[model samples]
Target: MTASPLLRSYDDGRLSLPNRIVMAPMTRGRADDVSAVPHPLTREYYAQRAGAGLIVTEGLWADPLGKGGPGIPGLVTDAHVAGWREVTDAVHAAGGRIFAQLWHVGRMTHPVTLPDGELPLAPSPVRIEHQQIFTKDGWLDHVTPRAMTTAEAEATIAAFAAEARNAVRAGFDGVEVHGANGYLVQQFLAENTNRRTDRFGGSLTRRLRFAVEVVEAVVAEVGAERVGLRISPDNPENEIAEEDAQGTYRTLVDTLAPLGLAYLHIIERGAYPALADLRPRWPGTLIANFNGPQPTTREAGEKVLNAGLADLFSYGRLFIANPDLPTRFAADAPLNPIRENLIYGGDAEGYTDYPALTPTPVG
Candidate 1:
């Protein structure tokens, strides 16, 4: 059979994907509120989209302090492992593979979400302006975060390693360390957010130390082939900025090149011109996410793959609205319109109710 540009099979040494489509990690607040465990609806949600070549689950808190908002899932406790086992089982039964995205929000969290109502932690004491944390009470303005001590930073790395082991116990095929989107890992990578004179801050090399160490620890728990890292060089969200974007990311890609990771996921928002320059530096499968206010279309994804920009393309909103995205794309069928109102903090209304093309009754 002649291979289509988007539907072609791909093997990246570690992952043998049926197609070049990836369901990118997206946070839908459908977990149980208090326990932070995934509800049944979360399991059904992932099983519905199992037709994708690969599915990266929503960002899960690695510890209590990492919890970013209400209804976000965690991978810390026994209850969390039991909750995710159902999710992984359903996906595997439906002939799909999944990877858990381990996350720590750091300063992006609010004290209300913390265990003792303590201030959130960050590489520095800088506050993320113009952003609010969603709480059980309501959305509140971000508070100033306490700078993490060197000891605290080391503990955080150890926590990440523990979470990686938990992900395996939960039956995940692999784990993706969330080092992007201005969270704990990116906060350390960015010069403005990380201003310490210690090993984890100051120069570009020091700033990258946290990310490198976290990846190393995770690799120790889970082998390098079962590990992936996501990075966004130009993202300005969560009050993030770097003095030299190109130079900083070039150094990062070079440092991580020797690790032999499964893949590298990069979220490109067009603001960073370094994607073209940085793509060739790393010799591994690259998953490029075209991110912005606008939704990514199949044609746009094909363009990136056709131009050799990325080995695979990841979609967010499209996969949310159409569970059977691959078949729909193959037949040029109509797509379900995304319900903007019900994107987050909702029930099965927007999560699992979207219908696929019904098969005709066989005579």
Candidate 2:
């Protein structure tokens, strides 16, 4: 079978690959709760799906305050680092490359999820529109978060920088900053969420300050070649909506363009225009998330390759059910059905139970 340009090598020197299909970062909530480390089973789980050209590990909390819910793993302590080392080593032993997705949930978290019911942080002290959050004390309505002061905001940037350092030390091939899905960084970028009047708010450039600063910090710590940024222009997951959608993200992409970052992972949203528009502006690799109908079918993936919309394709739910997803995609075989009920906060039920395709029985 002929390979599409989507399977071509990345111009960025940070990641080497035989194809361009990537196993997107997914949250499995299988961490060692007491120690805040990855469960041993988690290592075997990722090792099972080592066939993808690249695998982006689930979001790992950078600090304790960044925790969104119970069971989410972290990279804060020596134990966390040691636990993740096993995971990365397993992937490497299987001849697969992976990147650690550094993340923070911001106000999407509940006070109970925190150490002592401490208020979550946000750019403004506004409560988000009716949204329920999972906490240690069960589900609860999200409360108005405490507005971060300039000092606190700067310190938060430091915390993210430290997390990037921790990720490298934890034996990851590279790092991807979780800037999508209405998290802390997305909250700051969205006008409706960020109501501050300081350098981090008010104007487009100011609103994008947090994301730019985070990327700059990571670039400084580990070089831009190893840093990737994930952004979704029209995501409504955490009630994120920007008054000026296209203008805001265009500026966001253009500003980071000069940095020569590894890749821009764009989660496709209908409100946003064709990703091809952002292509000429960003010289680095472009990875698109297929969210809507038609999905990223082999035909559609090939079309994207021919049209040059993205350099790589990020498979989300498909990665969940098919550990050998790349091979299945190549062979055009039937996929293992995903059990939605077992998507999150479980043991090895849906997390690692998915089976790879086997040869049929002889007649």
Highest lDDT: give the candidate number: 1
The positional error of residue 289 in candidate 1, measured at the CA in angstroms, is: 0.3
Q: Candidates' TM-scores?
A: 0.97, 0.94
Report clash pairs, candidate 2: none
Candidate 1 colliding pairs: none
| Alpha-carbon shift of residue 125 in model 1 (angstroms) | 0.3
- Which tens-of-lDDT digit does each residue in 1-363 have in candidate 1? 234577888897789988889999999988987899997888899999989999999999988888888889999999999999999999999889899999999899999988889899999999988878788779899999999999999999999999999999999999999988899999999988999888899888999999999999999999988899998886887889877888888998999899999889998863766557778998998888877787898888898899898898999999999999987887778899999889888799989999998876999
**Over 4 Å off in model 1, which ranges?**
1-3, 360-363
| Candidate 1 TM-score over all chains jointly | 0.97
Candidate 2 per-residue lDDT, tens place, 61-120, comes to: 877878888789998888888899999999999988888998888888878877777999
lDDT of model 1 at position 187: 95
